[model samples]
Target: MIEFLNPAELPRARAAGALVAGILRTLRGRCAVGTNLRDVDRWAQAMITEAGAQSCYVDYEPSFGRGPFGHYICTSVNDAVLHGRPYDYTLADGDLLTLDLAVAKGGVVADSAVSFIVGGSNPPESVAMISATERALSAGIAAAGPGARIGDISHAIGSVLRDAGYPINTEFGGHGVGSTMHQDPHVPNTGRPGRGYTLRPGLLLALEPWVMADTATLVTDADGWTLRSATGCRTAHSEHTIAITDGGAEILTLPPA
Candidate 1:
């Protein structure tokens, strides 16, 4: 379902967005080479509980995933990309990590994801992949606003990823978010411009741009949640929840200045 937030509910949306952003920021800071994926999930739970907010993922039961994800955050490392459930693995130097989070507060929901490298070792390929996704996410956000078609955002994102020489995957992409997570208007990573749903005020979209280093194919881990590259190539993902506004797209999931 496609859900839009009225002006009265905008504040709640912002609050939820801020909470999600803050938690992600904190978790990112705590991650290190020796950090355990399960520890990361524990930190997320603590932060979400302290904020008096709900974790949209903990009890999430989407058809594509195993019922009740039972995790507070998604900790994707190295080859893993999307829907990475927390596990017993400990991060290693130069490991590319992606943290995707969603939280609900005041009856509104916000989602965001970030990719970064653990330790001081920054592999050139990993760095470039992460940068590409971030740039694609920015491009997608820049293309969004009132009257803009969803395709415009998709095209803008795809252009950046393609230019960076990464394969795009449309199997799972961005989507609308409001009272609940994962709403309508599937925003693919790549598409033609001037097509698809038109943007309007009050609309909230989680625009994510993810890419695999070598191929577009994905393989689900035995856990039935973690999506990894078919070739075991490193991957990266970047995302943010944006609100369509009168001026332009307002990024809701940004850490406070």
Candidate 2:
């Protein structure tokens, strides 16, 4: 279902976005070499509860994932990309980690994700991959605004990833996010410009650009939640929740500095 947030509801959306962004920033700061994945999840849960917000992930029973994800945040490590459930694993040096989070406040939802290197031994390849996704996400945000087509955002994001020499996966990408975590108007990473749904004011979207280092194929982990690279190549993901307004797109999930 595609949802359009009225002007009054936009404020609530911004609050939800801010809460999730703050939660993600705290989790990112705590993630270091030897940090347990479960610890990150616990931190997220505590923060969400403290903020009086509802987790969009825990108890989320999606068709593609195992019922009731039962986690407050997604802890994707190294090759893992999406739906990465927290487990008993310590982050190692040079390990690339991705954290995707969504939360609802005042009945409005916002979603975002970030990727970073775990320790000082940052692998050049991993850093490069992370940079590519961040660049692509920026481009996608730049192209999103009222009267723009969804394909324009997709093309902007895809161009950066393709030029950076990473394969694009269309199976899972950005989508409409408001009042719920995932919604209609599936936004792929690559598409023809001037195609797809026209953007309108009061619409909320979560634009995410993610890519694998080597291949486009993905393999699900035994837990039936984490999606890893088919060849175990490192991956990175970047995202932001934005609201379409009269002037342009306003990013709602940037963390407090």
Candidate 3:
């Protein structure tokens, strides 16, 4: 379902967005070498509960995933990319970790993701992958505005990834988000401009640009939720929830100081 927030509802949406961003930043700061994946999940759950917010992922049972995800946050390391279920793995230096989070507060939902290296390890390839996704995400946000077509955003995102020598995957991409976590208007990472759904004020979209280093194919882990690169190549993902407004697109999810 596609949802457009009324002016009054936009404030609630922004609040939800801020909560999600702050939680992500806090969790990211706590992550380091030897930190257990379950620890991250625990931190997220506690923070959500303290904020009186609801997790959009925990107990989530989408058709494509195993029932009841049972995790507060997605902790994807190295080869893992999307829908990564927290496990017993301890982070190591130079591990590329992606944290994707969504939460509901005040009847509104916001979703966002960030990719970064753990333990101060600065692998060149990992940095490149993360930077590429960030660049693509920025491009997509820049292309979004009232009256702009979804294809324009997708095209802008795809151009960055393609120019960086990464393959594109369309099976999973960004989408409309509001009171519900995932909604209509699937925004592919790559597409032709001037096509697809037209943007309008009050529309909220989660624009994510993700890529695997070598291939566009994906493989599901034994856990039935974690999506990894088919070639075991390192991957990165960047996302932000944006609202179309009278002036332009307003990014709702940004890490707080």
Candidate 4:
């Protein structure tokens, strides 16, 4: 279902967004070549508890997934992209890592994701892929505003990724989010503008633009959660939750300094 935030709940939404952002920033900083993905999940659990917040993932059980996602954060590495369930794996140098997080505070929820390289040995291809997702995310955000159509935002995002010569995967993209991590008004990576749901003020959207380095096809891992590129190529994802306002969209998730 598509859920919009009330004026009274805006502040709480902002707070939840901030917490999600801060957690992502902290996890990114602490992630290293030798860091274990499971340990990172543990750290996220501790931080969420300390902040008096709730994890949107840990007990989440959806038909798309094999079972409940028993983790606090999604730790996707290299070819993995969406729903990357954390496991016992150590990061390696030059590994493209993606961290997706969502949390609720004061009954409001915010979701966001980021992709980065492990260690200092950043491969040129990996760097370019990460940059493309970021650019697409920015383009999608720029296209969002009151009265705008959801297709407009999707078109903006797809234009960037496709123009970059990367295949677009529409299986998973952005979505409406407010009190829950995932909501209605599904936003695909590519689409025609002037179509889909009409944007309205007070609507909160998580605009994520993600892509695989080569093929658009995806293969599920043995864990039945992590989505890896079909060709085993690298992947990257970028996301943010924004609230529609009077003039334009306001980004809710900004990491604290």
Q: Where is the poorest 10-residue window by lDDT in model 1?
A: 1-10
What is the lDDT, from 0 to 100, of the residue 153 in candidate 2? 95
Better of 3 and 4 by lDDT: 3
Query: 1-257, model 2: which lDDT tens digit per residue?
Result: 88898898888988998898888888888999999999999999899999989999999998998779999999999889999999999999888899999999999899999999888986889889899999999999999999999999999999999999999999999999888889988999998889999999999999999999999999999998899999988899999999999899999999976
Best by lDDT: 3
Full-model lDDT for every candidate = 0.94, 0.92, 0.95, 0.93
Measure candidate 4: CA RMSD: 0.8
lDDT of 2 at 167: 95
Predicted candidate 4 versus true structure: per-residue lDDT over 152-219, tens digit per residue: 99999999999999999898989998778889899999999999999998899999999998899999
> Can you give the lDDT of residue 22 in candidate 3?
96
Native-vs-model 1 lDDT?
A: 0.94
CA error at residue 122 for candidate 2, angstroms = 2.0
Per-residue C-alpha lDDT of model 1 across residues 54-80, encoded as one tens digit per residue: 999988998999778999999998899
Global fold similarity of model 4 (TM-score): 0.98
lDDT of 3 by residue, 21-47 (tens): 999999999999999999999999999
How do all models score by TM-score? 0.99, 0.98, 0.99, 0.98
